[model samples]
Target chain A: MKHSTNRLFSLGAIVAAALMAGCVPPSAIKPVDNLSQIDNGKVIVVGKIELTPELEPDEQVLGSSYEEYRNLALVITDTELRQPADQLGIGALTRRINAPLGDNFFVSHEAQPFFILRSWLVMNAEIKVVSPNYVHVPGNAPLLGMFGIDVQPDDRAIYIGTIRYHRDTFFGTEKVEVIDNYQQAKNEFASKFGEQVQLRKSLAMPVMNN
Target chain B: MKGWVKKTHCFNGLTLLAVALLAGCAFSGGGRSIDDPTSSLVFGYMDMEEAPTSMDYVKLQQVAPRSEAGYWDMGTDDGIMYNQYVPPGSFKVAHFGGSSFLMGEHRYSFPTYGRNATAVTIEVPGIYFIGAYAYQEVDTGFFEADKFSIEPTENPSEKELLNTLLTMDWVEGTQWESRIKNRLAELQ
Candidate 1:
C-alpha cells in the first residue's frame, strides 16, 4: 500500500509541472516579417486570395466591362500569419475595379465604390502556385508581386506585378478588356490548392467539424 | 456505561487522526491544496466583447488584467473603456503563475480566447462541462486550446474583472462549469 501511494504522488507532481508550461504568452504577427520570408531568391509559394463583386446589368459605366468581378482584393501575408511582418504585408495589399458609384461595396470591410462584380459563379474559389513574373506587364512584376511592395534578396527582381487592373474578384463588365485581364489574373492567382481550400480566414463558425 | 463511552471517544479520536493525515499528505517540495471550500483557490478567463449597449458594459471591464498591458496585477479596463487607444494585443494571455499559498480572485485574458476585444467572463470554482471546446481535468490537462495558464489570485480586482467577460453558458452543469473547477484546482 505504501509503495502504490508513493507512486501516485510522484505522478501527480509531474502532471502539475506540465500544466504550468503554457502560461507564457504568444507574440503578435507583422507584415515585414512575412515579406522577408518571400525574399528567398527562389520562387516563394504564396497563396493569392482574390475577392470579386457580383454586379447586375447596366450600360454606359465608363470603365465598366461586361458583367464580371471587380474591386479585386489581394492578400499577400505569410502562409500562417505568425509574424509581425505578416501584418505589414497585408497592409500593402490592393484591389482593382470599375464601379457605377451608387451601391457601396467592401474589401476586407473597407468601403469600395469602384466596381460591383455581380454575383454569378459560386463565390467559392480554387488556388494555385505560380511563377513570380506570371504576367509580362511592362510596369509591375506581375499584379500579385506588387502586394509585397519591395522585398529583399532580389532588389531588381520586381516582387509586385505593375500590370494595370488585373484583379481576380473584380466588379464590372465582361468586355474585351475584361476577358483579357481576367484570363491573365486567373492564371496569375490559380493554384492546385483546389476550389475548397481557401488561404484566407473564413471567420464564420461552423456548427460541427468533419 | 462509562467503559462504553470511553471506547466510543477513543474510536472517534483515531478516525480524526487518520482523516487529518490522509488529507494533509505533504511531500518535501509539494503541497496538497486545502479541501476546505471557504478558502479554496479559484481561477478563470475574461473578456468584454463590445456591444452597442445603452449602458456601458466597459464599466465592469476596468478591474481585470489585460494582455495588451500585462495582467491582473493591475485593475480592470472598465476605467479606460479600451475604445480610444487600446493596445494592439490587449486581450490575449500575457502572464500566468501559481502558488502554494492561498490565491485571491483575479481578472485575466486568454489562453482560451484570443482578444479582449469581445469580452466574456468565466468564474473559477465548481466543475464546468465546457461542452465540445477543449478542456482538461484538474489533474489531467488534455485540452486543445493554446497559450494557456493559471493566474494566482493575489490581484485586487480579480472577481469584478472576470464578471465582464461574456459566455454562452450562463446556467449550471455546462462544460464551462466542469472545466472551471478542474482548472481552479490545477492552479491551487
Candidate 2:
C-alpha cells in the first residue's frame, strides 16, 4: 500500500511540474532604436509588419486561483481555445486587425493640434505586408489572493518588434526602418493633443434621410 | 492482498493514459478550409462617428446558416476591436458580398436593436475589415448601413492596428469556425 501511494504522488508531481512549465510567459516588450528624422506630415508606407499571436492555446488564463494543485487542474483549461496559430495560418495576424479606432481616441482638442488623422495612416490604406512573423503573447503568472480578488483580467497591452517603411525625402524616396514600441507613440499623441470639438459636433448631428 | 494491489496499479496507469488522450483530442482540427485549403480568419473595425454613451456592448451572430454568436465590450473609433475565425460558406459568394453576420448592440435604457448588412462576403485566409455602427432613427429604432465598406489595402498602418488589438482579449482556434462551416455545408 505504501509503495503504491508513493508512485501516485510522484505522478501527480510530474503533472504539476509540466503545467507550471507551460505557464511561463513570453519575453518582455522591446522598444526600437535609432529612428531617422521623419518629415512632418509625411506618410510612411508599410513595407513589412511583424504579426505576433496575441494568445497561446493552452496558456489562455481567464481567471486566477488559489487551490491545491489538484483542484487548480480543473479550472486551468476553461479559457483555452481548441486551436492555436498552427491551424490559423496568416489569419491569426489578420483577425486581430479588425477593430475600429474610436472617434475621440486619437482626435486632438487643442486649437493648434500637434497630431492629425490622415486617411491612409489611420485607415491602414497603403503598403504591402510580407509574410507575417510570429511571437507569443505575455502570460499572466498565477497570483494567490484571498477570495476571487486574485483573478484579474489581463491588463491590455500591444507587442511589436519592428516595421519596415518607405518615405519620400527632399532628395528622393528612401526605405526606413521604424521600431514599433507597441503603439506608445500614438498613446502619447492622444494624451498630448486631446480631442477635437468640431469633430464631436459633426458626429452628434442627426443624419438627414434622402 | 498482493493481487488486489497489482490490479489497482494497472487501473491508475490506464487512468493517466486516458486523461492524456482526452487532452490531445480536445485540440484536434475538425473542418476544411475554402481557399488553398487554409482556415479562414475574419476581422475588422466598425467606424462610428459617435456612439451613444449608453451603448455598452456589440453583439455579432452568424446569419447565413443562422448560427453562432459573440459580444464584446464597447469601443471607440480610436480603438475598435473585432476578431473572429471565418467559417467556410459563412460568406462564400464572390462579388463584394456584405456582412457575413449581423451586428447589433446592447444599451442600458433599451433592449437590443440594430440592423444587418447583406453585402459583405467572407474572404477565406484573408482579413476582411469593415467599418460599421448602429444608430436610432426616430420610430425606426436602430439600423446599420446596408453597404459594408471594405478596406481595399492589404495592410493597414501597423501602429494603428496594434493600437486597436491591445484592447481585446486573446483569441485562438478553429473548432468554432469548423462547426459553423460544417453546419452551413450540410444545409447546402
Candidate 3:
C-alpha cells in the first residue's frame, strides 16, 4: 500500500510539473545590433510604449497577495488581431515584443501588414492556485485598441509612433492612444542606428471600423 | 491481503486511464454526425485554394457571446462541410483555418466589433447553414508573413448541398433528411 501511494504521488507531481512547464511565456525578440543588417525584406519597427501609473518595485513587497503589473508586451500579428495559440502544428503568425515601460524597438521580419492587436500586461499575485493573470489594454473595448502599420519590402525602418496606455487602477478600465512623435522618433533612431538610416513615418492609428 | 492490495492498484490505474481518455475526447475537436434531428447543428462550407488532405483538416471556432468560451469543429470535404452539434446560443465564427504542406497553417479571425462582424444566433434545436466562403491568399514578400482573405461564395448551391446531405450514409434513414430539407427551405 505504501509503495502504490508513493507511485501515485510521484505521477501527480510529474503531471503538475508538466502543466507548469507549458505556461512558459513566449520568447521576447532580442534587440538587433544594426538596423542595416535587418535586410532581406525585414523591417525595423521603432516606437515608444508607456504605461501610466508606473508600478513600483516595492509594491509587490508590501502585500503578499496583491495583483501588481509585472511586465508589459505588445502582441503583434501578421494580418489578424488575435492571441496566438500555444500549440503544436501550424499556428497563427504572431510575435511578442516585451517592450519596457518606455521607449523600445523591435524587428518585424514579415513584409505583410502588421497590426498591434493589443498590449498585454502580466499581473502577478500571491494566489493559492497557479494561473496567469493577463490584463489587456483597452480591456473591454477591442476596437479602440487595434492599431495597424503597413511594412513594405523595400522599407528599412518604420516609426510606429508612441503608444500611451493608461489605466485608472490595477484592474480598472484602461485606455490606449497612439501619438505621432516622428521628430523625436527620428532622432532616437539616428542615435541607435546612425543618421544614414532613414526612419519612415508610418504612424500606427486605430483601424477604422468601416 | 496481497491480492486485495493488487486489485486496488489495478482499479486506481483503470480509473486514471478512463479519466484521461474522457478528457482527450472532450477537447479533440471531433464533430458528431447527423445522428439526432433534435440536436443543434451548425453547417458551413469553405472553398480553399487547395483541397485539404484529410476530412478534419479545416477547423472553425464557434464562440458563445456571453462567456466567450468556444470549441473547434473539424470540416469535411463534401463541399467543405462542417457538421457539428453546437449548443443553442448566440455564437459566431471567431476564426477558421487549416494547414497545408506548401502554405503552412493560417487562421482568419472574424471581426467582432466592425461592420463585418459575424453574428449568428441559434435560437432552436435545428440545423443552421452559415454562408459559404472562399479563401484567397494575399501576396506577400519572400519569407514574409502569409495573409489570406475570405469572400462570400455561392459555388455549391443550396440544391446541391441538399442532394449531398441526402447521399450521406448518416442522413439516409435518420430524420435529418426532413430536418435538412426544412432548414434549406427556410434559408431560401
Candidate 4:
C-alpha cells in the first residue's frame, strides 16, 4: 500500500511539472524592453508573415542536435545525444511559443484597428528566420529572427517588411526586407484577410465557441 | 391565530406602501420627457455589421439649441448580433439636431451632424428612434486604406427598436414598457 502511495505521489509531481512547462507567458517569445517604440495612438495591422525559403526545412532548423534530445529531460547520460534535450525540434518549439503571441497581439480586445490575416492563411505566409543573440542553444549557431514593424502614421499601414537579427559574430547587426513590396503585400492581405475588418466596421458579439 | 393574521395583514400593507413610494420617487426625476421640460425622450438602435475588436457605437450630438454628444454602447439581442435602447434624453435638443464622432482626427476637415445640418428632432412626451450606421470601405484611395463613414439609418423599424429595448436595462422609465409588451403580443 505504501509503495503504491509513493508511486501515485511521483506521478502527480510529474504531471504538475509537465503542465507548468507549457504555461510559458506570451512575453517570453518577444522582447518587451523597448515596447515604447510602438506608438499607442497608431494602429498596427499585421500584414502577411512570411518565413524565408532557406529556413523552411525542419532538419536545417532543428539541426542534428534534435535527433538525440527527444524531450525536455533534465538528465542526459547517453553519448549519442547530438543536441541538448530542451533544444530538440526548434521549429516546433518556435511555432508553439510565438504563434499564439502573434495571434493575441493582433486579434485580442486591446488591439483595436489591428487585424491579422486569417489563421489558416497566416500559416501559409512565409516567416523569415534569423540568427539571434537572445536564444542560446549548446554548440549550435544562433538561428532566430525578430520582426521590427514600422507603422506609417499618414497611411496607417506597415512601412515595409524588415526582419532584423543579430549577426553571427559577437558585434554588429543585419536587416533584410521581405521580397514583396509594401503595396503588393497589403493588396495580398486585403484580398485574403477580408478588407472590411476595421474598427469602424459593423459591431457584433462573437459567437461563443462552446 | 387572529393575532398572527392581523400581523401578516399589517406587514403586507407596509410592503405595498413602500413599493408605491419607491416607484414614484424612481421616476419622479427627469426620467420622463414630460417631467423635464428642458429635454425630450430620444432612443435609438445602433449597429455595426462587422464587429470591431473592442468598441462599436455611433457618436450622436446635439450641437444646435443645446450642445450634447456622447457614444452609446449597443447591446446584443441575437446571436453574434447587437441592438440597444439608448437611455432617454440622450438626444436632448430644443429643436432638431445631429451628432457625429471624429471619423479621422488627422484629417483637416471633420464632419458633424448638427450646426447648419438638420438635426434629429426630439418631441416632448414622445419617443423618437434614430438609427445610426457606420461602416468601413476598403481601398477608397490608397492601397489597403479603409474609409470609415457614419450615416443615419433609412426606414427605422419600430419593431426592431422594440427588440433592442428587450435587451436594454430597465432604467425606471425608458418609456417603452407597454410598447414592448404590445409588440411581443403581436409577434406571438
Q: Considering summed lDDT, which 10 consecutive residues are worst modelled in model 4 chain B?
A: B1-10
What digit string (tens of lDDT, one per residue) describes model 1 on residues A31-140? 22122333333222221232222223321121222123233322222222122211112133322222222221111211111121111111112122333212110111
Model 1 stretches with alpha carbons more than 4 Å out: A1-185, A189-210, B1-72, B75-96, B101-109, B116-188
Off by over 4 Å in 4: A1-210, B1-41, B51-58, B68-110, B113-119, B132-134, B143-146, B150-156, B171-175, B179-188
Write down the DockQ of candidate 1: 0.01
Interface C-alpha root-mean-square deviation of candidate 2: 24.9
Q: What is the lDDT for A66 in model 1?
A: 17
Off by over 4 Å in 2: A1-210, B1-39, B47-49, B68-79, B91-119, B132-159, B166-188
lDDT of every predicted structure (CA atoms): 0.22, 0.24, 0.49, 0.28
Task: Put down candidate 4 lDDT per residue, B29-72, tens digits, no spaces.
Answer: 21224233333334443234432211222223332232122322
Sort order, lDDT high to low = 3, 4, 2, 1
Provide fnat values for all models in the order shown: 0.00, 0.00, 0.02, 0.00
Q: On residues B1-188, what C-alpha lDDT tens digit does candidate 3 reach at each position? A: 00000011222444444433432121222334446444565666667654321122333334333332344444455445544455556555544533334433333444322123233567678766676766655565585444455567887765666667666665666667777777667767
Which digits, one per residue and each the tens of the lDDT, describe model 4 over residues A1-210?
Answer: 000101122222222211122342332123121223335544333322222222222312222323322111111111121232212222323222122211112211122322111111011111123222111112222222222223333433232332222231111123323333445545544554446433221211112110
Error of 4 at B171 (Å): 5.4
Please provide, for model 1 over B117-161, each residue's C-alpha lDDT reduced to its tens digit, 9 standing for 90 to 100.
Answer: 223233333322111111111232244211222222333233332
**lDDT score, residue A107, model 1?**
15
Per-residue lDDT value at B120 in model 2: 38
Q: What's the count of clashing pairs in each model shown?
A: 89, 26, 0, 15
Each prediction's DockQ?
0.01, 0.02, 0.02, 0.00
